[model samples]
Target: MRISATVAAVSGALVLSAFAVPAAQAAGSDAGSYRADVAKIREAAHAASGKAALSGSTVASPAADEPYALNVTFSNVKVHSGKPIVVGAAAHVSVPVTYTLTHGADVDITASDFLTGPYIYKGTYAQPTNMLFGEDAGTCTVTSATTASCKATIDIYPGDGDLSNVDAGAWKAGAEAIALNGQDPTSTTFDITKVGLADQGGFASPNVTRLSKLTVNAAPEPVKKGKTITVTGKLTRANWDANNYTGYSTQPVKLQFRKKNATTYTTIKTIKTTSTGALKTTVKATVDGYFRYSFAGTPTTAPINATGDYVDVK
Candidate 1:
């Protein structure tokens, strides 16, 4: 994924928490210097389903009554692997994004007024298929005068079927933030215009692969010191649609051998599977040892190694 110059700009700031004030410190009345009212805002911002919904039309460039101007800086977006999101067994995923909201002069901040989360949209910015991931509570902390750092952890769940029609490939990450009115939720809205779109570091679909199976066997269990010994195996992988494991024809499998009582195994040769994923090969049996078939995984499937089959040489 390529992050547009626009998305790359809004990549700074930190997380948020409930604004706290000591009994002696007076609340600032300036819009820009005001901190948010935590209690009332939480009720309006969060839904029972636990997913923050920021599904409103694009507000005019500068909406009226927009309490504060925004300077959002998102942290590097990454998956659990500390890399681009790699969809896998865990359908639900969360990515961390932080931002700093600078309040306007005398604009009191509240939870309801602020909402941030991760968004995925396909096509051009002018016209795109947009999907919101997660917008839960962003525990915030006030860092400087009129500046508050907020961190939001966004969640993505494929099972929700939001990106079902979307192709299984790269998707842009558009981190968003909005300021709403406590009295009138839809009144005025302000957002960071330039959200950082991750470059080669956005969302990814699970690389779907069929389950693969392999087998190994050795012939002439009691072979002579220098007799020719045969090793054979079949490599097959599951077909998702068919729900069965079938031949993985024309793929290569490494024939490996470990000497008796040895800890490591060395590759003897590379052999290709037949049209039916069948394997047959010969090697000189020198010592009682174990033979196995190893397959280097493909894009869609994971790598696997079969259990070693022992062959005894008299």
Candidate 2:
């Protein structure tokens, strides 16, 4: 279930056709093709039922208008161990996911055409604005006849339209599974009835934030007491659109000082970056200490602190 390509919409429903493996390559242990077929089946079901495109977590049973639902559920889902995903420009960020899959004893989860994994998305589950999935299929270890523990990796490419600045903030987690049952989804007469699908949503919420950077330099390495000392620095954050770090201007930053030989730093004053994200300030030299800058961060950016600059006050 790799998501290296951007998710596109067909008939107003998000589709994975862009990254779907070709039909000729669907015969192997290629879980990507199986997942893509599951998505296609979901789209067909939605069109038949005249409902909006359902999310990957939607569950359905063989009924008058839906594909056969697998008797499976996902639990104990954890992404990055509950930590926020902080991504930088132009780099691929890989996130680890772990979950427990519980299913009926009749379900053959180890089949070549069967695959399941966790995903994260922004917006509603039924209609996600954007979504991300693992680069490879999940690997599972059977803990019991009916349960398995699974681990997968979610690969994010900030430079490849996988994310944008507006995507930063909270994201919801979900899990999905599909069983093709040896059916050829690429056939024009492909039967959807033989496929099994299960989707579960709202298991957890994880934060995604842009990586931030800060740098500081205090002038006058050796200064006389009572003389003014100047501090200068810059603040920048990841720019997903440009695939680089750019100035994060007009944001509040803190000036901190730690006396020489001290292990703690205390805030000296609060200041804001210039239009170009540059920082400059002056403080009277009163003691031998180290100076630095700190950014408390925002909903879209991660917090960071500059390395302290040492100054010997004579």
Candidate 3:
């Protein structure tokens, strides 16, 4: 399908050429088109920001003395239906950039003179990394007597090493252009010199919940009234790195009980789990009731409650 856009220019209506990049190459799917490449970019971009570089340096833009001169602008920079980018959500990010290349008064040019797309980068200005939005990318159409409108999608992958491990906050966006010939890069240079952030909406790491386990038991099924009843249990949660569930040690949990026929369970005491996620506490039996352990969970795990253990009072 033909995907085109119209840019309202100061002079008049500027028609954009039909976007021709396939779904596998572009940053996100085209409007009304089903695609996953764009989704993959966002997932990698927000994944971890990877252990790339974290330098505080900058580079100078190319001199205007080059063969051609150009300027670029970006719009519709967002992730997943224009939602703010959340790390690890596995969604697509769309960043469409438009380039307007200005030729020298003495330099004669044709529509085919402009190259494919701009040089896109992610991360901070001091630590930016190169990004490949697609193959044979970018499209250009003459909009005025001496200017042309060229657009391309800058797809981003949050989880990919290029993005997976950066700090959880605002990041910078960059675009540059040079002259491209049969085998050489573009000579006309244009760059975004200000704070151009792809995620102007906001950036965050999404909360992840892992599996949690809780257990409870009471010794001496039949105990006389006034006799002490011991309740014990262990709490554990999934360990991502370890790839297994292990004891969640030194955490607080609640010891709760409910009398027979009672509709609500009351918290009797607060207890901490040992290094092995073990809990132990005792209470005097006054009537037949049930005992259980409850965990409130952590940022990485979900809350859980142990099945009630019943004890009979004589």
Q: On a 0 to 100 scale, what is the lDDT of residue 74 in model 2?
A: 90
lDDT of 2 by residue, 12-84 (tens): 3333222344343345645556446656765655544443333343324323534576788899999999988
Candidate 3 per-residue lDDT over residues 16-134, each given as its tens digit: 11123344434443321212222222222222222222232222332222121233333333222332333232234445555554444432234243333433333333333323243
Query: lDDT of all predictions, in order shown?
Result: 0.50, 0.77, 0.48
> Which 10-residue span in candidate 1 carries the lowest summed lDDT?
1-10
How do all the candidates rank in terms of TM-score, highest first? 2, 1, 3
User: Any idea what lDDT model 1 has?
Assistant: 0.50
Backbone collision tally, model 3: 33
Scored against the true structure, residue 300 in model 2 reaches a CA lDDT of 85
Per-model TM-score on C-alpha atoms: 0.47, 0.82, 0.43
Candidate 3: misplaced stretches above 4 Å?
Answer: 1-36, 39-206
Q: Global CA lDDT of candidate 2, please?
A: 0.77
- Judged by whole-model lDDT over C-alpha atoms, candidate 3 comes out at 0.48
List ranges where model 2 is wrong by over 4 Å.
1-46, 52-66, 186-190
